[model samples]
Each structure stands twice: as structure tokens, then as C-alpha cells.
Target: MANTRAAWARSHAKLDSDTIADAIRPLVEADPSIKVKSIITEVQSRFNYTVSYRKAWLTKQKSVVKVFGDWKVSYQTLPVWLKAMTAKMPRSRVQIKTLPVYRESEEVQGVRVLHRVFWSFYPCIVAFRHCKPLVQVDGTHLYRKYKGALLVAIAQDGNQNIVPVAFAIVEGETADAWEFFLTNLRRYVVTIDGVGIISDRHNSIDAAIARSNGYSRTEQEYNKNYQRLQERGEAYMHWCDEIGVDRWVLAFDGGHRWGHMMTNLVECINSVMKGARNLPVTAIVRFTFYRLNELFTRKSAEAHEHVRNGFTYSEFATKRVEESFRRAGSIVVNRFDRRNEVFEVREMPDGSIYTINLAQRHCDCGHFQVERLPCRHVLACCANQRLDWQVYVHDVYKMSKICKVYRGEFVPMGDPSTWAPYEGAKVIANWTLRRTIKGRPKSTRYLNEMYSRDMRGSRRCTTCGKEGHSRSRCPQHAGPSSTGGQS
Candidate 1:
């Protein structure tokens, strides 16, 4: 009996990913994020044999293909999918650039591979018109079978709602790729002039801005801040010079940037969707479509509800205005302009005097013109002059405009069977850009000096009772010390 069992064990068929994946396709369709361990358990329960981790991983990947379609076929069918999207939603912009396929040194005729593609939905393009006149651009890497970068351009609404206006999947953050995205963003999505773009001081970004185009501090204040940095070290000042002040300093930003200095808005979007990067190229597109559709639906409903409730501004804008109004009561306004449009405002007690020029839209405290909202000083000036203050609030803050942001309506791209027949050539994936790194994929993100900076000087020497050197490096740690720092 023992011999028979051993023979049967030796003779049992080994499970390949295709067979396991076929069995798990239904499970994957139910929940795409099902784990490999669960898959291994499922195999053991059904086949009475356990699979190795690698086999389970391979099977899970195969299940992804089965549920979402083949990665290779996804690349081939991408052009059809994009065409269908445009046909369903006219005026939506989609641009795809392809490179000729090369084998060794020779180019293959009629065969092309995807180089980069940028897209902006019609709703998002229109929504930007009502958003703040500033855009923040950011880039993140994609993982798994594909090698590339996802570049995004995002805007902020009066309610501080993040509006993703444009996106591109590109080869990498190369200068050429940035140029393509920047030019397309300006030409298609951000059509208005005088709109500013905020990004990290990448040389690529600098180059892109030269082709395309906040901080709202005063020049004198900026000069003083720079002087303090210079006193600390020349290297500090040199670093500031390397990254031009105009890019970050509000006062020097030419009034185009609305005092925004961080690409954190774009990063926030990227971080929330970090896990989605592992999806196949076509799945990535579908994922973005569904996510944005969800965003627009929820936001549009909220906008309508807010308007119905009699709120004339966004929740965030309304809160800001109310706070300014509360502080305005404590301010004393002195007339400056003969027409009573400008005034000198002094807050009670020790607060400094601020020059509020209603006609010129200038507030020395740097809030009125910067945000286009009536600051406390501006509100005080208006109150003292008996001028209507609501006019000072930018039109972008009005509920009617915020409602227009999502009113364009995202037309759902239904079943492919319902899509019009596509006659265009297939989009081929660049075989050269395929990921080749072996072993369990290492995290592409790396910790930098900033991540560990806080650890510096945090180590305490046990014997010396000091917060500099560690116990191992302490002078008295190993030299006849009977007690530790606490002792």
C-alpha cells in the first residue's frame, strides 16, 4: 500500500499556470486582487496537491490575463479602444505616437511600437476653465510587464478639489517625453494663456516650461529670506540659485502661480493609485476611465446638492470667506483712496497695519489678489466703504461655475460589442521596453537622505548619557562603564 501511494505521488501530473489559471478565472473575475496564497490553498483543496509560490504567482498573473485579456493583445487592441473612446465622446483629445519596430539594425516595414500617448477627456478640459489658473505636473513609474512612466497634469478647484486634467503613459521622464506631454497639455487641455505649471525643479520641467509656460510673496520679503539663507552658507544660496526663485517663490512667480509651491497634489493622486500600476497597459487605461468617471459622478452630484442647499460658493471657499468676515469685524479701516476704494486696515492690539487697495486688487498681507478671495483686510475695506464685498470674490468660486466643472458629463464607454467597428492599425507594445528584472520585482522606490535625516543625532550613547554617538560608538561604553545613560 505504501509503495502504491509513493508511485501515485510520483506519477501525479504537475500543474502549469495555464491549467491553474483556467480553474481560477471565475475567482479572478469576482475579485481581481485575490492573493497567491489563497490560490495555492484553492489548488490544494481541488487537486489534493500544493503548489510552489512561484507557480501560484505565475498562475495569478495568468488569471489577470484571462480576466483582463492578454497583455500582448491589450497592446494590439489599445488603438481600437482609444478610437472607441473618442467616438463615444467627441472633442476629447487623444494623441498616440509610435516608433518603427527594429530587429537588430533593420526596421521592420509596417510594424510599429508605441512610444508615448497623451489624453484628456472633454469634461476635464472644460472643467479646467473654471479651476484655478495653475496646473501641477508630476511623473511616476509603472511596474510589472511594462516599462514606462505615467505623467499627470492636475488642477485645483475653489473647493480644493483635485481635478486631473491630462495624463500620458510614456517611455520615461526623458526631456523629449516631457516636451510631448507639456506641449500636448497646453495645446489641448490647458488652452488658456497665463496659466502656470508647478513641478519639481527637474531640468526637463524647465525645458518644457520654456516651450509652454505662484508663490505670491512680495519681492522685498523674498530678498530678506534669501539673505538669511546666504548668511547660513553660500552652498545654501547656490542651491537656491540653482533652482530659480521664480519657480517656487510666490512674489517672484509673476502672478501666474496662485501661491502653490508643491507637486503634492499630483503626488496625492499617484499615491492613491499606486497599486494600479501593476496592471497591463490596456487595463491601466480602463482603470483610469472608470476612476475618473466615478470622480465626476460623485463631484457633480455634490455640486448640485450644494447649489440646492443655497450655498453660493464651494464648501471650502465659503468657509474661507466666513473666517475672513469674522476677522474683518476686529479690523479698523482708514480711508486711503479719494474714491474710498483703497484703505489702510489695522487689526486690534498688536497686529500690523495692512494696505488694502480694492481697485488694484492689492493686499500687502498677500491674500486678496493671490487667491482672488476677499481677505480680512479687503473685507474690512469694503465694509468701511459700504461697497459690496461679494464682487471681490473671483467668479471661479461661484457655485454655478463649480457645477460646470462636472456638468460636461462623462459618457460611459459600454460593452465593446456596442462600439463602432474599428478600422485602424493595432497599437503594438515596444518589446524593447518590456521589464527584464529577475526575482520578485524589487520596489522601484528608493529611500533618500530625507527619509533618514531625522535618525541623525537621535542615537543615545548608553554610557555617556548624550544624544550623539550610539552605545556601540561611545567612548566609555566598553571602558569600565558599570551603568548606562539612564542608570
Candidate 2:
């Protein structure tokens, strides 16, 4: 019997999703966003066996649960966790709306399903005050078990750093949802008057903006940097036709766009945070905490080092101002104001002349007022008069302000075992939104002929030669089939 059992064990062994998940627990704990293809290669390397794509995907889901806890429980504990976070870091704002649950004819007691949520960390709230007074808003789809849309607001620092200000999770980009997100964003994050909001002209956003004066932050506030934007021809005219030409056309904006051409700032933040969209709700929030904390800590230290190195302006401002100084040396200045602030500056040899107003921080070239930085003409005017040119540079460009942008640090969230008991209604999930079918759920997107063709002839991954996310984002940078130099 012992000889027969030994022969059977040598011939066969069981491979399952649970076993795969257990094997990759360390990798998942280290990096929760590790790719499934990496898991398959790792399992094969360890056990001398392979697993199917579906099983690998299942193992990932299980591993995520092991590392970050269950998705359903994440929803239930979200409010409690948020309360603890708020207590630890004062002034952090969070609003959660839950719909009441019902059974037959009677209402459920102390039970509710999540409707929407909005959060703005205190550090981000503080950071915005020191950034450029322009805000960019955008939304991206969430592809987890609970389908939702993440609305994000981003601001840009003097050094051109991306500052994520606020975020919200909603059912979709419906008018109501946009209204909720925009209203809260205006009230909480972008509280300054005369600030500009940059966004794509999505119909839902338009509808929400039209519904009330208080909805979108773009309620007649100005855009400053008209000269910097490279105007697109047809779409520019079409956008003018749809929403009054004032919003898109910088001619109407009173120098508030701040050298930004489009809504790329928010789009950039969306890409940076989209990797965690498929994570559990609590994990998504946790990911934000870790990501933003890392960002602030690094930037804060960098800003201090720059200050210690005797940098009065941010690196971005320093580079631009230095170039302006070089150009100012050659340009000839003609005094126009008795205060020695305003002048007409001409280029070296023979060139067109530009008007500069040091007091107003204006230039006929439009660089001074729009960018809030001293243009060549302004520098030339100041140099001809022997006046200090640093006075013309905006405070936002100063290293001191840049340091304040990241001064707020995130507090570590202690263990949950010490958390105070929550007194709010117990949260429930809307089961109707769950993918209740079998196996992996199919995309609900209506596949046209072109999409179908692409699906049929899809290309495989470059790194592992497997069909999925790209090489950089993929964990398996190389596969067994890849041949290279000596190991």
C-alpha cells in the first residue's frame, strides 16, 4: 500500500487558486498591485508547474483579500476608519451618504447601502493654498466588483508638481454625481475666489454647471495664460459654439489659466491613481494615503534642501527667470513711466518693441501677467533702472511658498484593535451591482465591428509575451521564452 501511494504521489499533484494565492502571499503583501502574469511565472518557478489565466486572476483576487481584507467588510468599516483618520488629522473633511435598506414592506434597522463618498485629506487641503490658484477636475471609471466612477481634483505647485487635492467615489458620471462632487470641491478644496477650473466639456458636467450657480468652480472665474495654450482649430470653434466662447477661449478669461493649455493636470493625476481603481474601497483610500504621504515627504525634503542651497525661487521659476535675465541683457529699455517701473523694451540690433509695466506686472508680450513670472521686457526695464527684479516674481514662485505646500504631514493610522466603536448605521452593499454570473464577467461595453476585430486579433504582452497590460506596468519584465546574456 505504501509503495502504491508513493507511485501515485510521484505521478499527480493538485494545483488550485487557493494554493496559488497562498504561495504568492508575500508578493501581494509587498505590492498589492502586482500583476497576475507575474503570479503565474512565480508559481511555475517555485513549484515547477503552470496555472491557467483564469486561475491566476482568481488567485490575485484571493491574495488581495488576504492582504487588504474583504471588499464587503471594507465598505462596512469605511466610516469608522475615516473617523479615526479625521481625529488623527484635524480639518480633513469627509462626507458619506448611505441609502436605507428595506425588507418587503418594513425598513431595515440601522442598516444602509453606500450611495456616495467624498474625501479631502488635510495635507492636500493645506497644500492647495500654496499652489497655483487653478484647479483641474476629471473622472475615470472604476473596474472592481463594485462599479463606480472616481472623481479627482488636482492642483499644480510652483515647481510644476502634481498636487492631488480631493477625490470622490460615485455610481457614475451622472449629472447628480458631478453636481455633488463639484459642489463639495468648490466648498472644501477650492475655496479661494477668482480661481479657475479646468475640465473637459462633458455633457454631464455641463448639465451640472447649468443646474446651479454654486455647482462647478468654473462659475465665471477667469483663465489667465491665453498665450501658452496652443489653440486647436476645429474643436476650438466647436467648443465656442457649444458653451459660450468665453470659457474655452482665453481671450475671455482674465489671466487665470496660469500657462496651462488644457485639462491635462487632472488627467495626469487620474493615470497616477488609476492603478488602484480595481482595489477594495478601503484599499483605494489606503493607497491614496500611502501615495500622497510618500509624495509630500519627498517633496517637503526637496524643498528644504533647495532653500538651504540658496534658491529663492522654485527650480522651474529659477530656470525661466535666468533665461529672461540673459535676454534682458541684450534688449534696450526705453523709459515710459516716471516711477521707473514701466518701459518700452526693444530687442537687440533690430526687432519689435514690447511694453512692460513692472507695477502691474504686465507685458505686451503677455508673459509677465499671465505666467506671474517676470518676462524679458520686465527684466530689461528693471535692469535699465537699476531696480530689483525679484519684486516682480509672484510669491507662489518662491521656495518658501513651495515648502509650505508640502508642510502638512500625514499621521500614521494605528492598529484597528484600538479603534473606538462606531455608532453609525451598519453599512450594507447593493447586491444588485455585484457580478453574480459565473467565472470572469464580460465587458458590458457594446462592441462594434472594429472592437470585435481588435479583440479577435489582440496583441500579446511584450515582456512576458502574454496578452494583458503593458510591459512597464506588468510585473514580469521577462518570460522563460526570453533569451539574454549570461545570468
Candidate 3:
């Protein structure tokens, strides 16, 4: 029995990369972070063989590349992959921009170059047509050779489901790149007036939005007036003037921006694609396609299920309506006219009066105006007038509208070999964007004032248990040795 076991171990130890990769491909795909030791143990249990740690690690590396494709050769396949996607789904749009090698410019001569690329799938476009006009845009860094930035534009459906509309791969998060992305997005994705864009106060994004004529003049003037009343310094006021309050501030954006104040939705998309960022550009795009396909399939099914259950609105909207009804009891309604379309609701607890205009679907409190849902005041007025509050709710929140957004089917890109030839110049990573320094790359995120922590608050020292200083800077902790033996 011992001799047989030894023979089995020896046979397993001799397992080649291809054989080991085939065994672990499913495991890797399921959990990309699976350890080498786990793989070795699994191989030992399944095949009655033992493999070294180094061998297992090497096998896992090769297997990942095999399954996901080599990062080095991934960029060359992007055009073809996009072409196949567009063929399968004709409504899908893809644009690629490449920088030509110029002999006159010594800086860019004889280097791998692909400047930027943008793509928007058909289902996402169709879905956004039924969603709110608000969109959130943000960028995240890619991890791999020939590093670049991944720009994402996302919107929220009536059901509060995040719908990704467009994606772009740019050289970096510069003004030019953002402008290109916004230009493509405006032309192909969100070709509608009164669209609200939410993002962090990134200078590049502000410049891009300004150049694209993304906001209306009314929004600009509203922001200027709003900022003029603030106690912010002249420099901050000037900066706000340059960027325009309508670009980032929700209050000054009139009714176009809805209530979205930040690009958190786009950040969520970045987190979803965290694992794929380390892969090649083509693999990253492929991963996005598959992930989105999965999302659409699952969300569509969920929407259908909700509708089948006879839900009038989404679960979130339903809950909000119920909450408004509960609060409606304390609100006393007074009609302004006989039409009953306009009224004033006075809250008994605070004696604050809010005007509810059913015709405009608005309230003085701003909730009804921004969310397009009946506020507590509106609900109270509707109750007093024997009117249906549901009529005042926006069409986008209705179950029918939510269902329409996800009804479009996602067409599959059959096979790579079947893809038509892409005769464009072989796209490669711009080496300028690649990190030269060794250690793990660092990533930073910009946070709006609402999300940012108040570091100006008093801090306590860990050692002395006092406020206004840290442990390292605590005066009470100063030792006699530091006083040159004076103690």
C-alpha cells in the first residue's frame, strides 16, 4: 500500500502545466484569489498526486493567462472583439482613436500607441431611454502593462437599479480624454436635453463639461447666485465661478440634475470591475460584456417577477409611498383654489406650511420636485381632496416603465475565430502611462464635501488621553531623556 501511494505521488508530481491548468481552470474562474496551496491540495485529493508549491503557483499563473488570454496580446484583439460585438448587436456603438507615429515628433516615434476607445452596448442604451436623465461619470485606473484609465458613465433606473450606459479607455484622466469621452457620450448615448451629469470636482471633468456645453445658462446663473451667498473665500468663489455651481451643486442645477449629488453609482461600477482591472484591455472589455450580460439577465428576470406579483411601483418607491402615507396624518391641508390641484399643507408638529402643486408635481419642501414622487405634504393634500396620489408620481417609477427598460435582449458575441478581420493599425499600450517605479501601485479617490470626513474636529492623544494632539506629538509624553538629562 505504501509503495502504491509513493508511485501515485510521483505520477502526480510529474503533472504538466497544461494538465494542471485544465484541472484548476474552473476553480480560478470561480474565485480568482484561490491560493496555490488550495490548488495543490485539491490536485492531491482528486488525482491522488502531490505537487510542489512553486509548480502549483506557476501552473495557476499560466492557467489564468490561458483562460483570460495573455495581457501582452490582448490589446491587438480589441478591434476585432468590438467588431464582432457590433455585428451581433447592431445597435451597439464603438469608437477607437489611435495616435499615429510621427517621424517629426521625437517623443512619440517608434512606440506602441492606442490613444482612446469608447463603447456602449445596445441593451444599456435602450434601458437608459426609460431611466432618469441623470448620469454619473467617473474614472478608475487599470492595472497591467500599458496602463490606462477606464471611464464609466452610469445612470439609475426607476427601480434604483444602476444602468451602465457607456465605457471609455483613455490614456489618462486628463481634460482632453474626458472631453473626448463626454463628446462621444453626448453624441451616442445621452442625446437628450435637460440631462443632469453628476461627478466629483475633478478639474478635468469640469473643463470637459464646460467645453461640451453640458449645462444650460440658467443652471450657470443659478450656481453663481448660490455661491455668492456662501462664506467661502474669494479663491474658492473664483474656482466655483470657473467650474459653475450647476456642474457639481445639486441646489443650483434647477430640476435637471434630480437629486444625485455624487458619482457613487459609477464608483460602484468600478468596484464591480475591480478584479478585471489587472487583466489586459481586451480581457477587461470582455469581462465587462459578460458581467453586463449577467446583470441584464438577472435584473430583467427580477423586474418581470415584480410585475407578475402585481406591484405598481418598485419596492423602494412603494416603501417611500407608504412612508409618505404614514406621515400624511400630521399634515393639515388648506386649498388655495377650487380646482383642488394646488393647496397648502401645514405640518402640525412644526407649524411649517408647504405649498403642494399637483399640476406641477412639486412641493415647497423640494422632495416631490426632485424625486418626482408625492411627498408627505402632497399625500396629505391628496387625502383631503379625495384624489389619487399615484397620479402625481412620475411615469418612470411605474412598474411598466421599469419593465420596459430591461425588456431588451442582449445578443451574444458567438466566437473570436468567427470575427471579421480588423485591418486597423495594431493597437498597443502607450508606454508613457505605464508605471516605472516598482512597488504596488497606489490609487486615490476624490470625495465630495458631503462624503468627506471632518479632519478639523479635535483629535485625542492615545498616550496622554488629551484632545488636540496625536500620540506622537503629545507634550505630556516627553521623557527626561529628551531634556538632555535635566531630569
User: RMSDs, each prediction?
Assistant: 14.6, 10.8, 15.0
Q: Residues 1-487, candidate 1: write the lDDT tens digits.
A: 5345434444444466799999988887656667789999999999887878888888888788777887789888788888999998888999999987668999887667899999998889999988999999989898778799999999988888999989999999999999999999999988888999888755343332232222337766767666766676777667658778777577766667775666879988897557566677777787777788889999999999999999998887789989998988888889966997768878898777888778888888877777888898888887887889998888888999999888877787899999999776656888888878854666678888766858553765443456777646765545445455455
Better of 1 and 3 by TM-score: 1
Instruction: Note the clash tally of each candidate.
Output: 4, 6, 0
**Candidate 3: misplaced stretches above 4 Å?**
1-22, 31-60, 102-112, 202-249, 435-487
Q: Score candidate 1 by TM-score against the native.
A: 0.78
Question: In model 2, which range of ten residues has the least summed lDDT?
Answer: 221-230
For residues 39-63, write the lDDT of model 2, one tens digit per residue.
9899889987666788888998888
Which has the better TM-score: candidate 1, or candidate 2? Answer: 2
The TM-score values for the models, in the order shown, are: 0.78, 0.80, 0.75
The per-residue C-alpha lDDT of model 1 at residue 213 equals: 22
Alpha carbon deviation, residue 449, candidate 1 (Å) = 30
Question: Which consecutive 10 residues in model 1 have the weakest lDDT in total?
Answer: 207-216
**Poorest lDDT segment (10 consecutive residues) of candidate 3:** 208-217
Q: Which is better, 2 or 3, measured by TM-score? A: 2
Compared with the true structure, the alpha-carbon lDDT of candidate 1 equals: 0.80
Question: Runs in model 1 with CA error above 4 Å?
Answer: 1-56, 102-109, 202-216, 442-487
